[model samples]
Target: AQELLTKISEKCFKKCIAKPSSSLDSSEQKCIAMCMDRYMDSWNLVSKAYSSRIQ
Candidate 1:
């Protein structure tokens, strides 16, 4: 879980945050939300596939 959150933060920050600021604007917030959702979805899909194969 910690690794997953860290990966999500790193990837999404790189993709969405062009500049460091005190706070995020609405667009940045939206981008981060969408990016995290997509990343988690992809992670879950891969994890399920791997688990099925290992079992």
Candidate 2:
């Protein structure tokens, strides 16, 4: 869970955040939310595939 969050934070920050600010703007917030959702969806898909293959 920690690793998952760290990876998401790092990747999304780099992609969405042009500059490190004290707080995120509405656009940044939306971008991060979308980015995290996509990352989680992809992660779940891959996890399911790997689990099915192993089983």
What are the per-residue Cα lDDT tens digits for candidate 1 across 1-55? 9999999999999999998899999999999999999999999999999999999
Q: For model 2, how does the per-residue alpha-carbon lDDT over 6-46 read when each residue is reduced to its tens digit?
A: 99999999989998899889999999999999999999999
For each candidate in turn, the TM-score is 0.81, 0.81
Q: What is residue 18's positional error in candidate 2, in angstroms? A: 2.5
Backbone collision tally, model 1: 0
Model 2: lDDT to the true structure? 0.97
RMSD of 2: 1.6
TM-score of candidate 1 on Cα atoms, chains taken together: 0.81
Per-model root-mean-square deviation over C-alphas = 1.5, 1.6
